[model samples]
Target: MSPWNWSDLHLRDPWWLTAWLVVGYLGLRALRRRPGAAVFYSEVSLLRLLPRTAAQRVGRLLPWLRVLALALVVLALSRPRAGQEEFRIRRQGIAILMCLDRSGSMETPMSLGDTQMTRLDAVRHAFRLFVTGGGPLGGRPDDLLGLVTFTGYAEARCPLTLDHHALLELLDGVQVARRPPGLGGPLRPASPSGLTAGGGGELPEASIPSDPYWAEERLTAIGDAIVAAVDRLKDAPAKSRVIILFSDGEQTAGVVTPAEAAQAAKNLGIRIYTIGIEPNQATLREIAEITGGRAFTAADPQALQDVYREIDQLEKNPTEGRLYTQYRELYGYALWPAVGLIVLELVLSSTRFRTLP
Candidate 1:
């Protein structure tokens, strides 16, 4: 059998201890009393004459036995319990606000085997993996999630909520461009595939360069997005709040700088984790360092998935402690048993072991 463990074992009332002490003192006094001359006996003769029955033997020991049994009954009344009662514990879960760059640059087609997939497509795939229970992200149904998207201007796509299904659906519905034209940049064509001609000459496939005119509108507003996300989570009640920013490292449009936004988050006790979809280590490192968070570079879909998985682990296993408490009440008809034991002792003493005159 397994050993029993109890959270609480001490007596709740110190008066009960004093009462037990008094009872013990009285018992000792009773045992030490001298018999009167009228009740005195040369006991061997009388004891031999008595019937050798089990009831008689029990009667002889009844006084001390009754006292011991009463003590046990009183101790039971003190209500010893092996475990604590159930309580409603409030275990605070992590709050995460995902800030994704939806600038026109995200539409650039990256190769996936023979096919092509946009950066946005890769990001959405990673997000889907994160929201579904327990792979890399370790996201539980209980964790609160929020969403933000940024192009020229940052906007809250969804508020903080524990509704995972709704959040996933919202994420799926997010398209490349939700705002009007000329906001971020014009979509560029796929990169050309280099080929060798019959005469050893290089043949370049048709390709379109990203529009350079909207440099400010298309790339620079990431700081604004971070600031907006931080503002949204400022009054949140969770024990730990986090911001996961996904960007392509080109920042050209917002009023605030990434460093300033990171300072704002630090002031509000929010940690930021920046994931750069392209190979931009310098930008990623700056964002990570400024906000005291981690930076990950995802050059491919699998690497992006790994980054999200790491975020999930960080969320599930936070660096905080928790305390818990419990209580219980027990009730029964104790009066009857106490009275019955007293009466039984009295009857056995008078009838079964009565003294002769």
Candidate 2:
């Protein structure tokens, strides 16, 4: 319920208020006639001289009580709500589409503090922190974020939205791409010993191919990922549009070359910040350069988290929007009163105001 003021009060179903006309008509008709006048009295001058009893005086109120009850019922039918508050919000926000590589090569183990996890798992953890805010990252509260996963093909896992919780849920479900059973190669680990450390330790720089079947599983479609991101980010309404390309391998499968996709992104005023999980950064550096963005190589889990935090700082825009809370339902305020009045009317009509047929 709200104070009876125009600014705070809102009628949800105003059409129901039209029922008041019927109640009003009934009230006027009730006022015109005596309600319990079933028998006529003739030659009764002596009866008029007698003092009226308490029951007869109080009985006059029954018709009005019923009318009041009906009026309350009509009021209840017209649902009422109250506004809490409203304000204008101004924030520096950006739209970011994170392009993640899910190829089998991403199964390479990496160190995260005292625990060991797959490269994809490390990236997922960093991304969750980046969106929700933890440690050094302030989180993207006002920014629109999306997701794109790629192996041999690129797929948009989530659309650009302010709902980061839903985006993170989809991100959690992403797994390394797997080939069919009859495929020539198995998902062999890139490094059996796991060449990564947490506190700025030396990371594996060279792509040492120990398994002959490695090439069959490592189908990273970097170009297709960029193109997919561009398609999703081009029409964003934010002041700044960005794509974070996170991958451990070069472009091994795709129709469009990485250079062409970068050029397309540049034409559409979209920046692509490339982060290489592996040390080979030639293609990533070129892609960043073509789109007037930056590239970084994350040797370990900490480095990957740092890269995302830096990107959050680099892309900033001042955005204006209105914030309004949903209205509070006030129907119960009217509805309960209407029910009470109805019960009271029934009890009085049945006892003190009882009439003959």
Candidate 3:
């Protein structure tokens, strides 16, 4: 909620107010210094003989009444106005696309106090804290969330939607696996041990391979992931769109380079915030500069979580909001009061208040 006003009621026009004071001073001087000349000499005894009634009292007050009327008229002429305005904000929930690197490199184990957790695991924890728990920091729950996962290729795991629970569910299901076969026979099994000849006796349960392809895949197509997220948000409503890219300092395979993808997002009016888990300053700088967003290097899970929380803070409260206001002087007739004061002064001098010659 916000408020605006055109003219502040508390503010006064110094120039006009000064003029009023000057007029009052002049009136006082004329009454005190030339009281004999300003009023015609007459006898109050004549009025006392004529009548003793309410009219005589009313007549006596005319001079003071005129002075008060003149003061009010001066006040009105100053163009005093009190204005108030209010805003009716339509809360347009934000549209956010979270691009996560799912390359095998993301599996590197990092120490969590005495315990060790993979990069992917730490990200999941932070992500959970952001969604179901609250903002990765303390962001509002009403913001829309989307998801993108990339390894050798990029995939839109979730579209822009307000269903954060569903989005988190999709994120939780993410896992590092070999890139799907590219225009070839059925995806090659992750291991040869999984293949066995069918036998009259059911082949011994395909023995699990001892070597589970622990080496991180050689490709991380971060650029493609950003491009995909941007494309998905193209048709979104005219609200601020943001992309939070989480990666471990690598981009080996993609049709577009990271710079090109950042340009595309910039052209589409989307802000990209890059969070690099790796300690590569050069790479982090490039990503941050290209996307016109800040670069954050997280050496550990706590830092990583903090980065996400900061982004949430930025999201909930935008830098600026709409404003509109108007101001008008209600009425302007200060001269009327001055005129009334003159009339009262005249009547008082001609009647009961007149002095004896």
Candidate 4:
């Protein structure tokens, strides 16, 4: 793999080496054609008085040094390369479907930095770091990534894809189920001014769960989110399949239960990592345990980011290649020496080898 290993040297364009040979021949021919130094000395006896210094002795080799430099430059033009050795490596990657719950509870704002922000907003920022790629997470470029969102019903926001930009756009749209200005169990959507609720507004009677016309289908459906996540990751080609569930509340709607979904996930060899974001019920832990996966809890923005980082560490793809190749460029070996020799030759010619016009 070393470019300096002469035995492993290879020229990409062997034809360029012809330039080196031609330069060498021309250098010798020029030496033969050049006449001996001539001076209009009145007598040869006067030359004996001049001392032959070390610089003058070294100047005699300047022409040879220039010729060698030119030859090396020609060698560099051929673009030499080093040996390429391939070795086998085993790489591992997992197909992950991020199942996020956008229930109303996510509207709970906590201190993200100097200011307060909603859990959903914080989760979105964490998602951006884990998916769009920032530090530590480096992103899952090799693995296929997908998004599944849920509140009362689960929606596949983006199918498993390598295109992170499109996925990020979908994540950006995921909003917490703000109580539609009615119920007190969960906060409603953020008002234009801020996420805080109206001026001590009383819960309207019609909006209660007991109300016959009330739509229960719009509550947190953790089970259904798991189901959708499983559906998204079932067909992935990666050896390892994972689902990261982010939820804020217990399941209120959805045909299948989280337990039932967990069984299905276990059968399909999919690991479900559950993340509870300011959760109301500890349901995520139960689901994670059932599915043979770990559960994480994030109470704030920084914690949510840290949870993502931990998951990133746990689920990232393993080294996948059985064979690999390494190469080094050797042009520097020739090019640098040529440059040094050229400089030395120029310095010698200007100093010790100076001639009168």
Clashes of each: 8, 0, 4, 13
Q: Give the TM-score of candidate 1.
A: 0.56
Ranking by TM-score: 4, 2, 1, 3
Question: How accurate locally is residue 139 in candidate 3, as Cα lDDT from 0 to 100?
Answer: 51
Best by lDDT: 2
State the TM-score for model 2: 0.58
Please identify which of the two predictions, 2 or 3, would achieve the higher TM-score against the true structure: 2
List model 3 lDDT by residue over 253-295, tens digit each.
6788888888898888888888886567465567668767778
lDDT string, candidate 1, 38-65, tens digits: 5556666876687788865665566665
Off by over 4 Å in 4: 1-6, 10-91, 178-205, 208-217, 278-280, 320-357
lDDT of 4 by residue, 86-196 (tens): 777665557989888776567778897797888888888888898757877787767788998887678888998888788888888877654344434543432222222
lDDT of 2 at 30: 80
The residue pairs in collision within model 2 are none
Task: List where candidate 1 sits over 4 angstroms from the true fold.
Answer: 1-77, 80-92, 108-118, 140-143, 178-220, 313-316, 319-330, 333-357
Clashing pairs in 3: 42-355, 42-356, 130-136, 137-309
Cα error, residue 247 of model 1, in Å, equals 1.5
Alpha carbon deviation, residue 247, candidate 4 (Å): 0.9
The local distance difference test score of each candidate is 0.69, 0.82, 0.69, 0.76
In candidate 2 the C-alpha lDDT for residue 126 amounts to 91
Superior candidate under TM-score, 3 versus 4: 4
Predicted model with the maximum TM-score: 4
Clashing pairs in 1: 136-309, 137-312, 219-252, 220-251, 220-252, 220-253, 220-254, 221-253
